[model samples]
Target chain A: MAYMKDDQRKKLAVDVTRNSKGATKYILITISVLFVFFMLILPLFSVIVNSLKEGLGFYLEAISTEYVLAALGVTILATVITVIVNTFFGIVASWALTKFTFKGKQFIATLIDIPFSISPVIAGLAYIMTFGRSGWAKPVVDWINDMLGTDIKIVFAIPGVVLATIFVTFPFISRELIPVLNAQGTDEEEAAALMGAKGWTIFKRITFPHIKWALVYGVILCTARALGEFGAVNALSKTRGETFTLPLEIDALYLAGSADSITASFAVSSILVIIAVIVLILRNIFEHKSKANREV
Target chain B: MAKARKFRGGRVIPGFGLTFGITIAMLSILILIPLASVLFQSFRLSPSEFWGIISMPNVKHAFATSIGCAFIAAVINSIFGIMLAWVLVRYEFPCKRIMDGVIELPFCLPTAVAGITLSKMYSTKGEIGGPLFDWFGLRISYTHVGLVIALIFIGIPFVVRAIQPVLEKLDSQYEEAAYILGASRRKTFFKVIIPELRPALLTGFGLAFARGIGEYGSVIYISGNNEKEHTQVVSYIIMQKLNYLEYESATAIALIMLIISFILLLFINIIQIRQSRRTNNI
Candidate 1:
């Protein structure tokens, strides 16, 4: 113990404390990394690997089946429709909220965010209550049927599926655009108006250029969400093969209680996972670009 | 002054009348009517009937399990999410961008996919669960723990994203001053850093908790759906009731969920407003 000189002993004491602190930091980092790896990354890798566990023949066979193709078609159709409708509403709502001052403006903003908070199941049930067999829309359905001599189905049909999708995804694009437009403000828009530019022309020349990326970002997110919708679509889709979207098909296959169906569930999940990865990549790029633009 | 303001041109650009009209019309048809109809339908039942449905022991149990699991999951996410945000902000590491990107997977991935994948990975005979059961006699899947795990999976990104930017924007001078004053790192962290992070933390917690409550797809498979075991969530129960053609009861539960969610949403909005006000002041 007495072998070391006084200053050297002090230096050694300092070294020990710093080393212990370093060790603690390393432990914390290790735990954080391991937590993410186990909780997030591992399950993702397992799903992807399980999808390819069978030979290429099995995978292709599973994916190319008639049911799977139909499910894919439904998902694409729903996503395209959701993106278009929601994109239009998003633009108009954001434009009005940002470009104009009106009574209950704050109230309207809060109203748009309602869909985000409500459960998808509740949203589905809400639709059912409004448009199902025992719903408020029975009168409307009857009127249509009597007037047109045609039975038009709203609930438990494709229209119901599309409406529920729209309901669940209603807020995504508008929520995205509100902040961007709010920040960009009325200066450019007001200046363009002063130049005798009409609404469409002003939007095309000034507003659209600034908001094009944000619109795409919102549309992509809306489409991703719309494609993956389940509970709402599940409520409206009582007929299995007829109303099933891709996510519903995955759930159906998993619940079918057969080995082949279970494997196919994994395969379908692989497709959704691939789409999610693409969305994540696009989101990252948009985030980077927006941040750079903000700095400028 | 306000009256004069109201009488003036509503907007600088044209289409105030047209755009406002369409926006409100779309909002009404798409969001307001559908959500309101559930409440209106629930109102059809007499007061006694409303009480009868809500007072069911199974319904009570479902609410308890759903809210309880979500609360527990949000708490877990809050602690670990803070650690994660701190790590991401305070240190440089390999594959950091990938880690950052991956945090939002729960947001983009379909909840059903998350549900099935989680169930497969955590079932008793599965990879993580197999060794866990063999080593520790713990069964996660088809249990309350599994349900909480699923919620935590979906809720983690909310907390991490909420805190990351706040941590990045936090000034280092506060920590440096605490250090120079001879306060230990632990003391500085608890005293200096956490206080500044409280708003963001609360917002994240509320967001995660609300999301956890409304979660249906990711939790259904992992939860085991054991009504007798108190694992069935309200959302699942609503779906079950609908399947059974019990519209009244389903609407009743839906209304309950709607009320709780609206309260939470209002709370988060308040926090956000306060937060923005603070940033603007700064």
Candidate 2:
């Protein structure tokens, strides 16, 4: 009878622990969901609601303003140029750092990551100090402009905006590619070199295929960042319609302090919101593709 | 060292020179030269002059607000981040994939959009802020409390992303052993699980803290930037200097921030290296 009673107590203990485990799981899930909902999801939802607070027609008119369109153009142009330039740099840098051994390789890698740590405002300020009037590079910039017989501005212009975007996003593609390339090792490339195959040919046939998804992944991230770049671009792009990107335009509109403009700001923001959503979806898809490639 | 030099020279790659040349040239033009400009501009000021600019009461207050808020936000994120990472990795739930994807929204979304939306939502008349204020006489937007809320929003992804992989790769055997050794669930989690998660948690905290410290866009809208003593952040101070065209002062302040960032980066890198060494040893 005493042994039976002990067994009953043990079963009760197991049942109590199981119930507590279930309670813990549900509580954790609820807290996480609530936190994300309040912090992330709710704010994003309000953007849509606030954008349409007036009417569908107002939303359309807000987004169709000339300045908004121009800002959109600048944003797309900067993103495209940055992606092309950085993609080339990323490919070459990753190739050099991973395919061969060299001095200061670690230093170079760290240098590429410098932008990630530096504030965007500092990056923009650095450009202003470099190419603005009284800057060290002012003479060089003027010489180039004089030689070309063209009046070109660097600091408070499109060039400065693009330069800042590039500085901020310089590391993304290379950062993504480095690990994949490092994991690939150099055995195949060495064998191909031994067979008298040229670098371009081997890269096209082997390396390109391997890093294609990763490159796409990197480019997507870079494009998203460049498109949304505000702080750096803001420090340099002082003029509204001329130099502003989408994010800057949003800031200007919101700070305009009229209810109409605030609504308009949300309206303009919805365009970026849509683009960000698209980018996020693409990022998810490409992330999975890259992971699958790695697994294989 | 001699053997290493030989191995370096023995690389079979054909485009080493070509690739290395492009990489160095671009790196110098895009990164090194521009950053040097900040350093050189600040160097033009005397040490006392530099100290005077960054040590102003307003500037000191801004720095304090920024660092203090960022630290608190990072701490809060680390706790919730662990819970989120645990749920995502260990629990099966509906819409888990969608939830996972939503975590990257802050990373991809324009900071301006996030700034505006968050400010509106937390403003006195808005959805969440309305009830909050009425029930508790608490205000969020246009205050330092609002600043922390914005920082917390931007920082969520950093902690979660940092801890997710580590949590996923954790061996459950240790936890089972602790449990079987008669430890309660709380004891097992605190003693066995948390110690294992320490490196990842610290990494997430560092990253979130660093990001928050440098954050400008999201905080600016909600921070009610008019209050110089309470809500002004270091980044906004730099912006204000630029608006007045006080380039030297801006660069000096930026230099201070740059130094702090480098120290934090070094700290994180050391942690990562140690973590890797430990993993390899095991």
Best-fitting candidate, scored by DockQ: 2
* Candidate 2: tens digits of C-alpha lDDT, residues A155-259: 889999999999989999999999899878788887898899999998999899889999999999888888988889999998989989999999999999999
Local distance difference test, each candidate: 0.86, 0.88
Candidate 1 residue lDDT tens string, B164-204: 98887776666667776988878878999999898899889
What is candidate 2's CAPRI-style docking category based on DockQ? medium
Clashing pairs in 2: none
Interface RMSD value for candidate 2, one decimal?
Answer: 5.7
DockQ in order: 0.52, 0.55
Model 1 chain B worst lDDT window (10 residues)? B1-10
The CA-based lDDT of model 1 is what?
0.86
Docking class of 1: medium
